[model samples]
Target: MSAAFAHGLIVGKFYPPHAGHHHLIDTAAARCARVSVVVTASTAESIPLALRAAWLREAHPQAEVTIAPVVDDVEIDYADPEIWSAHVTVFRHALALAHGGAPEIDAVFSSEEYGPELAHRFGAAHVGVDPDRGRFPVSGTMVRRDPASCWRWLSPAVRGHLARRVAVVGAESSGTTTLARDLAAHYAARGGPWAATRWVPEYGRTYCEEKLALARRRAKATGLPKPWLDDLEWESPEFATIAERQLLWEDAAARTGSPLLVCDTDALSTSLWHERYLGVASAVHPRARHDLWIHTSVEDVPFEQDGWRDGEAVRHRMDARFREELALRGLPHLVVSGPPHARLERAVEAVDALITQGWAFAAPL
Candidate 1:
């Protein structure tokens, strides 16, 4: 008999040992006498095998866990037994240690696709613990590449590390401005610090104007080809600045300690417009990163102009483009339904929905 197996072995990367991971280990240990956790990072980037081992060990001190480093031979074919066999030897050794590492182990627990395979290869009963059923596959690549934008997907420990506190964004005339004011007012009334506005239209104009002035100055100074380069680059400095401000709001949110750091508009609009106007579709962009997007429709509300405004034909076209933008960016946004006032209510509800969806909050900090 397989030593009357009762304890299990669990294996994973354990990148920050999030709750989901801790859950797997805990649940596995319950079923088995002891669950040996193997934190695998055969060729991890920068994060050393030793450090990864330490983190796993520290996180699950009570559990009978053994951390092992498996080195796969890269010189041969990716799927060759030569490569896998060597790694399997390391795995087998890890299992052997787990049997007597601290407590009695008898089973194998896994929440990944290859966990069962590993279990079968190692001669352990496989127990699947993924109750979430892949609803939200929060990948390491997405979190590392754009933490601010993808912060909601992170574990609480990682999310807390983010500098910017809160962000609100949405489609054009989507009540982003109204919603921002309402949210700030709500937060302020609740005895919290005030939030920062994303666009602050005046700032946008001023920023763009400054960029234009600089371009004028640069054109005068070096004379870098008029319409071709000078005006083209100078025309949308503000747009680029706003794009960078997307990242800035996070910092501004951190400093404020407010319940919500609302942005009237974010980089998505700026980037889209920059592409449309400045021919910067290929050039450098500031790149904004607002958290929540509220979609506003001007179906009933007249597309009124405040001088710095574009027409419905443009807004309509932009609206269609905005959907594409959201899809491309993997952002979750709520539509502010109804006429003017209805938009306001819908925006409030939509934001409230987003909060519920992400489990993100800091007790007004």
Candidate 2:
């Protein structure tokens, strides 16, 4: 069948693209030979215009997605005819550039009431897709106000923006790693209304293991006793490096579209370890900010004498330190005790509560 229009235009701020936006674009693409989606943003906006454009391009590869340049000292409220006219001028210029000429728009596609006026200005027909929002039943305002609650309406890219970080942290042999993995698995299996879950393993553990291996290689060369983990003193520089690397990994995982990140350990825990061995807690490492913290209790979980681990006394001391530091810093955290399975349940409960409570804080640093 011949297409209804030679070229169709759809425009929105896409403040964070949701299902409704997708539906509008898909509807336009179906009726038109070619569709151009213009994503606009203002200086006051937090989400980048480039990011939103990229998301639209990825989400609808068949459509030509373009970013409308930010116009200074211009209001973006589309209800105002003056503001709407300014946007139309910008979008027309952008579309012309994208098409390499005065691009002819056959139709203007949108889910908003301004569609008719916009189309009339561009000398095109207005094609409204779900103006009542019966199809998607969501809006950008709804998603922005309570993302977790409106998660079902969000795209993976949007969910990435709304994802929450939950760090599982405590003293050694406190089941922090195991709990982190389990929590990730639980969320992944549950499989959103939100995006999938991601787990970040302890970078400090990997760092220590690599250092221990290097020490072993040196000992072998000298034909001497292999150095114990205790022989090497923890320094502020090493802890700082570990914290930096941990943050990097966490951020990388977060960008992968997972709405929930279960981190095995964060920088604050590393700071506690720094104090334990180095006798001073330097604030050089960036504080790992998490929406929720699960502090695993060391009492029920047996302290395995791993080659890298400090003994039971040190474990107890570190446990106390974690509590003291958390309290002093006024960070919110839940202490998960009991057996492994029970601890997992407690951690799950806490995470669910946070997700249900809805995102209120700013995106993770």
- Write down the lDDT of every candidate, Cα atoms only: 0.54, 0.80
TM-score of 2: 0.73
Candidates' TM-scores? 0.44, 0.73
Using TM-score as the measure, the top candidate is 2
lDDT per residue as tens, model 2, 1-365: 88899989887888778999999888888888888887767667777777887777778777444434333335657668888787788787767767767778899998888789999989999998999999788988877777766777777666656689998989989998899988888888876543367799999889999998998899999998989887775667888999999998887777674668889989888888788888888678685558888888897988897767888998998888888878887888988899989999988888888878875533311
Q: After superposition, which runs of candidate 2 have C-alpha atoms over 4 Å from their true positions? A: 1-10, 19-65, 69-80, 86-109, 122-138, 145-156, 185-195, 218-225, 233-237, 255-258, 287-289, 361-365
Query: What value of lDDT does candidate 1 attain over all alpha carbons?
Result: 0.54
RMSD of each: 13.4, 5.1
Show the colliding residue pairs in model 2: none
Give lDDT tens digits, candidate 1, residues 182-242: 6556545544122322223224544655655666678778977543222444356656666
Worst 10 residues of 1 by lDDT: 192-201
